[model samples]
Target chain A: NAGVTQTPKFRILKIGQSMTLQCTQDMNHNYMYWYRQDPGMGLKLIYYSVGAGITDKGEVPNGYNVSRSTTEDFPLRLELAAPSQTSVYFCASSYGHGELFFGEGSRLTVL
Target chain B: AQKVTQAQTEISVVEKEDVTLDCVYETRDTTYYLFWYKQPPSGELVFLIRRNSFDEQNEISGRYSWNFQKSTSSFNFTITASQVVDSAVYFCAPLTGNQFYFGTGTSLTVIP
Candidate 1:
């Protein structure tokens, strides 16, 4: 169904390098979120958007940025990749307060 | 303050054995949603179940079941007769207002 699609399944970046993780959903959900998962630590929300052109920060919003330009797309940008930023990122979309449908995830490694 | 807690870090059970994953969450909001997610070795997240705080009845789906108790602030998941394919990491998450938080996931191993 291509519920939520994320590009760059895996990537490796050097310190100070920048990249964007692309995410798009076809479910027409209004709420979209970006989360990062480390080795053993739980998933931490980086940013979220309730609708187009609206974004908000979550628990660990540092060193990350997100933009919601359309109802079907929400992209997360790593302005300055750091060693601590090596983790897997997930993009999810939900219909209002409904269940969240997550993407396949993008794994990034920063050296 | 930690909103969701999964005390069990890892659990190993043989095939055809029952396993229960514990999840405890604390939230001040009366209206909230609790959910469980499964991440297998494939590195993809699968949504298992979603329960609202007001629903006091337990739910069963095939070999999977959920016990949601508001008095103890816990939402536990149990898998009956677990097979080798059931091995994966389970995460408990709670959504309060517009904020959603996930627990440190419990890794499960089903040995055949």
Candidate 2:
């Protein structure tokens, strides 16, 4: 079964460039989240959505943005890529308070 | 604020040896959930186990076991007779409301 799918597994961007990390789930879960993992660090939440049209900021929301237009899709946007934004991003979804299913992750590099 | 701590940064054990990973959490919410996830070299996360606040019973599955003690705010994972395939980074997460606060993770190496 296709749990969570993320596109552009790897991307390299120049300074001030912009890009979007796409995330979609086929499980029809309402809770979706975006997290970034830096080297030698834990995953930090960037944004989260309870349902379509409802979004909130998480621990490390700066330099990033997200939108959940449908129940299955939550895309993270980087307006002006910075070196600090280079990290592996993961998308996850859960049904209610159930277990979370994560994507394969997208590794981004900015120079 | 909720927090999860994995004091052990890295642990190395030979094959067929038992290894234990510690997880400590801090949360003010009376009702919460705890979870363990394994991230191998493939970079994909695999769910290990989930425990609720009221459940203190230790669980065992195959060579893996979990100890949950709400009194001490600790949920530890143990692998008996670990194989080389068990080498991975283990993360502990405590969920409160809709947010999950994850620990920094403990890297385990199962040498053969």
User: Could you give the C-alpha RMSD of every candidate to the true structure, in order shown?
Assistant: 1.0, 0.7
Q: Name the lDDT value of residue A28 in candidate 2.
A: 89
DockQ of 2: 0.79
- Clash pairs, candidate 2, are none
lDDT of 2 by residue, B67-109 (tens): 9999999999999999999999999998899998889999999
- Which residue segments of model 2 deviate by more than 4 Å? none
TM-score of chain B of 1: 0.97
lDDT of 2 by residue, A1-111 (tens): 799999999999999999999999999899999999998788999999999999999999999989999999999999999999999999999998788899999999999
- Lowest-lDDT window of 10 residues in candidate 2 chain B? B50-59
My TM-score estimates for the predictions, one after another, are 0.98, 0.98
**iRMSD of prediction 1:** 0.9
Against the true two-chain complex, what DockQ does each candidate achieve?
0.84, 0.79
Chain B, per-candidate TM-score: 0.97, 0.98
Worst 10 residues of 2 chain A by lDDT: A38-47
TM-score of chain A of each: 0.98, 0.98
